[model samples]
Target: MTALDNSPNKIPSVTLDDVDSSVYSLYEKREKIFTRSIEGFFQNVRLFTGWPLLLGYFLTPWIMIDGRQAILFDLAARKFHIFWLTFWPQDFGFLAWALMIAAFTLFFITTLLGRVWCGYTCPQTVWTAIFMWAEQVAEGERHQRINLQKAPWSLEKVFKRFTKHGMWMGFAALTGLTFVSYFYGVRALVTDVWHFKLADTALFWSVFFTIATYANAGWLREQVCLHMCPYARFQSAMLDEDTLVVSYDPQRGELRGPRKRNADPDTLGLGACIDCFLCVQVCPTGIDIRDGLQYECINCAICIDACDSIMAKMNYAPGLISYTTENKLAGRGRTWKRPKLVGYGLAVILMITLFSYSLFTRMPLELDIMRNRGELYHEVADGLIRNTYLVKIINMDRKTHTYQLALSGLPAPRMVPDARIVAPAGEVVELSIDVLVDPDKLIEVNTEIEFRVETDDSLWYATSESRYLGPEPIRSQNND
Candidate 1:
């Protein structure tokens, strides 16, 4: 046989005279994420805030103040009730303004501090944490869970899996029911669900939401933040380099490899990191923070806790991974009051001011007047030309009101039968009224008259300026 190196298109064995430090060994398999339990100042803070927030979500539907649900968005009635305020469709502008204010606040917060909402306040994170906690309780800690996954099927394993999934479904069902309860009062919802009297739409939606919650929180926990949520994609636009984000100190963590705890770095020539991989263990998204700041990182700081603990054990200063800015880490002074953040702050302030002013100036009563089209002007007794108009009054308040109507810039304008109309809350009262003017006073076919209405209880007032139809007269006399 011909020598291997002498064969046509055959390559000789290659040797690396100088090994490249940047090149890494490739593994065919992926490592599993076993997030170790961590406890520290920030971890405790997160637990304190996260637990209460979860409790509030599950219990809010049952909470009642003054014989009514504390918060109810009644879609059927087209009313939103929050504490003492009841808003109708006519007051939808308030809702729009409120949404604008919320969007601006989110923008301002995101610009100032990156992904704080996603980390702490997001429902997905909260629900996923709760589900994971339930799983941990049922299946033991991360190590035990990993062991269980590797072990053969056993009665104990089956029981644990069944119990964990059962509890997850229970919590998800509760979440779905509570969400629906806001639209249909909790009491009514409980009664209907208990009696199996749910409408097809309600039952379908409730089941769908329950299934969605369970699958998302229990199964797709990190995937939701990484891929599904639009906020994760758009949040980058709101963030600047000045925004505080969880970052790794590459300057101190580079040349990372397994090393002795107290080994001299001058001899080994390695950075601060001992390559324990504790940060990866604590990350919910299962990413190495030392790799870089990834979009998947929710800035939850669990990795910070884990790394800090590792640093403490190594007798090194904490903050190998920390909440810091690129500039600060790059040896530049950092300030929270950066110009971009300040601009966002000012815009938020302006939007809030405008929203609050609009809310304060909103009128509770509305008047709509339509002039009679069949007969613009009709002759009344004593040579009087009368015009007919229809008035529709809408009341947005929570109480019934009696409104007294009056007409200005007319000889005599009054309601067809009377001058007062009563309108119940969230109801429209449409009635006809007439304005009589003497024929001698008529100089044109349409005369403008201001119609005003004041509630008897002094709650609201409205006005509509409409034209009173009349006859043109004395054309020859006005020729001069």
Candidate 2:
């Protein structure tokens, strides 16, 4: 044993030449996939569902509500207007809650329906679908487009490519314009565009969003779902056996082979699957559904459409590939009682309820009282102890408010000048006021006080708690 066995088995080392250096490389050249189009039940559903969403996206910014943009996010003004409601910077916590609710809702939907969001309602999918349609219109069908790619460059190729890219760029520009309109009023944005005089920020974001849309929808396409999206990577953690997913029924499709349309699958020892590979061809990610669930699958159900159409043509029962749960496909009875799903569902409901309640009960005004730190109390004539306060009032309503201020918790406390405040709509007004209290009423060095503000026009009211600093009560002569 000490002689040190020098045999190949005993002292194995990989030579530099023997090591597959390609495996150690960081990057891989990407393969382009041209997705073939298909039509079936799910395809029709996707198409129909996309129309209303697209219409809403394009048309929402143009809608007016109460003489202002309906759904404008006025970042410069720090105001968000949504139809009848308006939010200020202080309402940002509501936005955070809304985002959390949305996230939990997405999780709940994922736990129940897999990646249906990604497949249908996701912005990437919708834009990609539109871009693909444009490509088909410009470059023809999938096979023709593939042939065109392989063919040597020619006038026809240049023309087609230019047209396709032109259409894509136009769509991207439109999408960018629409997105920016949410921040800038749509009418103003449209006027700016017409005059070619967009503001610096507007121009920059428009160009940025346009380039992003073009790159994501036209060039990246499936690669966005495959390599870039983190959702594709982590979706497995959100999934379980009972969760519905687009799947291939291996039990019915395992002995897959081509046969005549009318051939008896039993006698021929075949299955419902004719091994046509249409599912793969139509798959945006270029994956085979028969190979079992993969992260690359978007659950678009295009494969299901393709397979079902093929089955219909072959006079075989459909659903060779379909939306189903792993438990059902495995002959286990479907169960919707999973703890994680129920938890996510309950969380979504709770968050929605909380957000709605908070929104409904939100006040239209905010007030903050900041005491002057330089001096706690000032002794002036007439045996009055004065405390200076910086009162900040924010009007969240759409109309200007004249608030009448009142003080309590001390006897005969009076404001030095006026107790009235005027705050413009969506504006913060800070006023310096001196609160005077009679020395006879001072029982302690610090006394709790309340500042109440009420609007003259409506029942809107807000209160701020503050402390009034006063001189210590004079000790009686006998006690001293």
Give the 10-residue window scoring lowest on summed lDDT in candidate 2.
2-11
Model 1 segments beyond 4 Å from truth? Answer: 1-34, 62-67, 150-154, 262-267, 371-390, 425-427, 434-441, 457-459, 465-467, 470-480
lDDT per residue as tens, model 2, 1-480: 222121111112345698687766465556677778888899989988788899999999988977899999999988999888889988998999999998888888898999998998888999999999999999998778877887999999999999999999999999999999999899999999999999999999999999999999999988899889988888789999988899999899979987888788999998788887788878877788899999988999999999999999988889989999999998999877898799999998999999999998888898899889999899998878999999999999888889988888987888966757889887899989999888776777888999888899658888999999987766432257
Q: Clash pairs of candidate 2?
A: none
Tell me the TM-score of model 1.
0.84
Query: RMSD of model 2, in Å?
Result: 8.2
Error of 1 at 391 (Å): 3.1
Choose the strongest candidate by lDDT. Answer: 2
Span of ten consecutive residues with least summed lDDT in model 1:
4-13
What TM-score, to 2 decimals, does candidate 2 have?
0.90
Please write out the lDDT profile of model 1 over residues 320-387, one tens digit for every residue. 89999878888988777677688878888998898788777777788889998998689987787878
